[model samples]
Target: MVELTVREALRDAMAEEMRADGDVFLMGEEVAEYQGAYKVSQGLLEEFSPRRVIDTPITEAGFAGIGVGAAMAGLRPIVEFMTFNFAMQAIDQIVNSAAKTSYMSGGLVNVPIVFRGPNGAASRVAAQHSQCYASW
Candidate 1:
């Protein structure tokens, strides 16, 4: 078996997805021009170019909504939230917009987007994970 680090695995997965589908694109804070917040997406911009791997502002809700809309419009999006805390800023978009797009469209439109973010220690909230259960 190939021994790969967590970052390598994630990078490979994203790369594979992007390669398999041209519509699949990743956008979020630091994803491009910064190599990701945790550097997991390092070299992706060079490999996929800036259009596929994009960087955005600190506004999660705005970008999350954009991702959802893009997905509804037939483009696959990979939305990175940076962390659960950051995701909190887009909880409504994730739940209401992305999650319910198909239902709201009468089972017609499909929001084929992937939502990603850091977990556990990234949040730095020890023993407070359960508090996010309801929000998630």
Candidate 2:
């Protein structure tokens, strides 16, 4: 058995999925060139190329919406946030758009996407620098 950190496990799962499906791709801030904000996307850009491993500006709503749209188009997208606190910027796209698309379309439109990020607060961080939204 192999012991893997959460980040390593997440990266491996994504690599496996990408290897298994041509439609699977990953996108997020620093996910490509910077190796992810938390280094969770370490070597994906090299393995999948820029076309599949994409980087986005800090506009969470913009990128998350793009991911949702891609999923609606039958592609599997992995959308990573530097942290879930920033995800609030894209809550509309996540809850109203992606989460509702299938039901709103009567199961005709399915959004196959993954939203990943570290949750909760880091120890010893400033109050404004940490947030926990697990209850929500």
Candidate 3:
């Protein structure tokens, strides 16, 4: 058995999927040059190049919407939000667009994408950044 950290596990998953299928790619902020906020995509840009591993701007809503569009168009895009707190800006894209597209389209479209990142509070992050709204 290979032991891996959460970041390493996520990186491996992305790499393996991208290698197995050319349609799979990753997109999000800090996912390329910075190697991801938590380094979950470390070394991926080096292997897959910028075309498959896109480091988008800080516009979460824009990038998230783009990812949903890419998914609906038959490409498998993995979207990272840095943290769930920031993802709130793209909730409409996720819930109304990505989540409802397949059902609304009667399976005509498939959103085989994954939106992942750290959720909930971390130590010393304080109220603004540490708030946990899992129940909300």
TM-score of each: 0.89, 0.95, 0.92
Clashing pairs for model 2 are none
Q: Relative to the unseen true structure, what is the C-alpha lDDT of residue 77 in candidate 2, on a scale of 0 to 100? A: 97
User: Please, what are the lDDT tens digits per residue for candidate 3 over residues 1-136?
Assistant: 8899987888888899999999999999899999998788999999999999998888888999999999988899999887768888899998999899889999999888788777777876755556566898
What candidate 3 gets wrong by more than 4 Å, as runs, is 124-126, 133-136
What is candidate 2's lDDT per residue for 5-115, written digit by digit as tens?
999999999999999999999999899999998899999999999999999999999999999999999999999998888899999999999999999999999999998
Ranking by TM-score: 2, 3, 1
The RMSD (Cα, Å) of candidate 3 is 1.5
CA lDDT of 93 in candidate 2? 98
Residue 63 accuracy (lDDT) in model 3: 91
Winner of 1 and 3 under lDDT? 3
lDDT, candidate 3, at 66: 96
Q: Which candidate is the best by TM-score?
A: 2
Among residues 3 or more apart in sequence or in different chains, the pairs in candidate 3 whose N, CA or C atoms overlap within 3 Å are none
- Stretches off by above 4 angstroms in model 1 are 122-136
Per-candidate local distance difference test: 0.86, 0.93, 0.87
* Evaluation by TM-score, superior candidate among 1 and 3: 3
The digit string of per-residue lDDT tens for model 1 on 1-136 reads: 7999998899999999999999999999899988888887988899999989999999999999999999989999999876656787898999998898799889998999898876664455565331344334
| Among all candidates shown, the one with the greatest lDDT | 2
Native-to-model Cα distance after best TM-score fit, residue 114 in candidate 1, in Å: 0.7
